[model samples]
Target: MRFYIQQFIRTIMMAVFAVFFLRLHVTGELARYVNPKYDGMSQLAAVIFVFLTFIQFSRIWKSKKDNQAHCSKECSHHHGDDHSFLKKVISYVILIFPLLTGFSLPPQTLNSSLAENKGTLLSEGQSLDIVQESDDHQYFPAVENTDKNHNEKPLPNNNYLQEEAYQKKMKTLEDVHSIDMNEDIFSSYYEVIRASPRDFVGKNITLQGFIYREEGLHSNQLVISRFLITHCIADASVIGLLTEFEQASSYEKDTWMEIEGTLDVTTHNGAELPIIKAKRGRVIKEPSNPYIYPVLRKMTD
Candidate 1:
């Protein structure tokens, strides 16, 4: 009973923090402390937590003399009251394991886990490197070279030349916009980018919009977003393309740019790939909202 009371107090405190953590103004660090990812999985966890906490509270209440006295008349069994604390601990740990894992792992790490394999885990060290099937992003392990290595003679002073080239590349990219969206690339909403995942599975596509970051995903990829609303931007969820440009290094997240590229299909873990493709285009900064379209849950063309 005492253990249950202590658990109740801790759960209450966590619930309070979760409310504030999900608030719009909360910083990422604070939010992670309370709700971690705050994505669908985290939201589901909060719901389950609330449900289980109530069940525990009910059990704790039933342990009291007044509750037992009143409920005994209506019920025949209070078997859970006699359950050992070790059994309770084991049961709670099994039930709450998912929530603990969800809140503890970083969001991007979660993405990799979803995309790759269940056996994958964050490295013991602090490095951002992840274990993936390929080196699609910088944080993950390098991909194996698919091209066969011929026994060609090595270039003289290869290391020095590579260093010099890298330095020059860095100098060129110092002022480039991290994200670029160009409005002219796509004439109308439907005319350029196709919304159907079926039709565009293996084709090239382009999109332009303001940039935003997502948890459990790569940072450099542009989330070409458009606000869909039944009422307003508050309810305006984003539906757009997730792509890497052929010359994408110049653009920054949230910077506007018009992308011109081909469509490609990719599979992440078991989750459907979020319409990822390749493109070659110019990036240009502009106002956040360039097009005015009706906000619907799904885009139908």
Candidate 2:
């Protein structure tokens, strides 16, 4: 038993990893950690962990003769018993900490308070059209999203779109009289609006996001913001619109709301930016999945 104790502990470690990853998938929480487009790879990791557990378990009961079946006993490579007890304990503790926390703590839903650490949705001179998707945004051609002209779809896992669907949404943007800014098309259309704020002026638009405020906003104004994430939440960027209304002061920060009004242009630092003249709005519950993903238009339309 002493000879195999380290082998037993290693086998248990591998098994725990397999269980942790598989549980995230079973409970549909894997999206909380990474972009859904990469789910296939994550699931593969869980599967590989399971395979390793079986393979490592086989090593625990092997006799010295069978252990040498793969490599000669003369092999110089390190094995389970190679390290001192204290060294082994320290190394394994480091490996175990993240896994234990992953199971013991829930993935926090990124909200307004925590989002400030990421920075303001837009800088004083930042133009929405200049906000390009970073390298991580490149995935499955075009992402599936919602627009005013189309029905909303299930989010998080199914956010990436087939090429056909993406083109249709792009075309819809050009032809629609009103814009519905759902998670799927929010970032894309924001670029269009800022690129030519005049073109969208008087256009009635609707959107939903948590309330956020920053410097340069009036007391009657706030930013309706969402975190734009790719791969992981830690790297999320804030994206939203500057909106103003008399009732804005009545609502506190971090309040989630759905609002509709006309799109109007405002000047800051002599640059034209889009601002929502909110007509009517109501507080709403926080979304189940609040993060907005950046999309890639794989094919030219």
Candidate 3:
């Protein structure tokens, strides 16, 4: 009887897990806790949960029909060695508490308070080459009516090699100069700014994040920050850029805001850091999906 009861409980727990994942994915709350790249994996796990529940239910049904038949001497001996009542109760509590909480409370994004606790990663300064190249490559106007003596000495023997090198250089230059802080590339912009703060100096940027102020920050200094989660909320880390605004004190901590500014390099605690000198700022509602997923390759590397 106890075995059948335990199997029934296990089946219900599996169903709960499956339902939790489905609800998170359907409501789009999964992104708040984990990177979207892993959404497929979560769905796969949910399917597995449903499959296990089916297997558990089959076992429970089989046990019920054969209760008397399976009561052989060996079965009796094994059942006598079942886990203690206290241990069984503890296991059930461990499985049910999280499911209950997930159902009862609303999902939340990591905010400024959690940012302070996790600590921010925005202090290093590295040199970056900011070379700009025209995207359009048009052939230089062919020399017209040039003197024979100055005629472009039939193209060099390594002309193809030189052309390839030039194209490669132009591609690199284009990448270095491009910095977009829109929703699609917010995390990429953050990575570039963190990796090489000096390269972005004087570039205009617009982004939204909660205000975070740490001890020792000047009255005018605050951070515009967001949480970066690769796997799940448990592993979330704070990434932000420092900002200086005269009226920073007017904005309460943890308030979401959209800020437009120019990137500037500044010194803080003897380390050069990227600071956004805000030109305009305004309060904004928090986004439904607040956590930013760092470029996966960069995060793994």
Most lDDT-accurate candidate: 2
C-alpha lDDT of candidate 1 relative to the true structure: 0.40
Q: Please provide TM-scores, in order, for all candidate models, with all chains considered together.
A: 0.32, 0.80, 0.74
Q: After superposition, how far is residue 223 of candidate 3 from its true place, in Å?
A: 0.7
Q: How many clashes in each candidate?
A: 21, 2, 0
Candidate 1, which ten residues in sequence have the lowest lDDT sum?
A: 152-161
Q: After superposition, how far is residue 177 of candidate 2 from its true place, in Å?
A: 1.9
| Residue 165 Cα positional deviation in candidate 2, in Å, after optimal superposition | 3.2
lDDT computed for candidate 2:
0.74
Arrange candidates, best TM-score first.
Answer: 2, 3, 1
CA shift of 37, model 2, Å: 0.4
Question: Model 3, 136: alpha-carbon shift in Å?
Answer: 35
What residue runs in model 1 are displaced by over 4 Å at the alpha carbon?
A: 1-198, 246-250, 287-291, 295-301
Candidate 3 Cα outliers beyond 4 Å, as residue runs: 1-3, 62-65, 70-76, 120-179, 297-301
Residue 55 in model 2: shift from native, Å? 1.0
Expressed as tens digits, the lDDT of each residue in 1-301 for candidate 3 is: 3366678889999999999999998987887777777778999999999999898888675444455666765563554328898998998999899999999988876777776676544443333222232224211222223344333332211111244444444354336543445444456567657667787777777777888887767776688888777678899888778877667877789887767777778765556677777766777666667666654332221
Candidate-wise lDDT, in order: 0.40, 0.74, 0.68
Compose the digit string of candidate 2's lDDT tens values, residues 1-301.
2257667788899999989988988887776777767778878999999999999887677577665667875888875567788998899999899888998999877777766776666555543322122233222222123334233434653566668887788788777888898787777787788788888877888998889987666676789988777778777777788887766777888887787877778776677778887776777666666777777555544
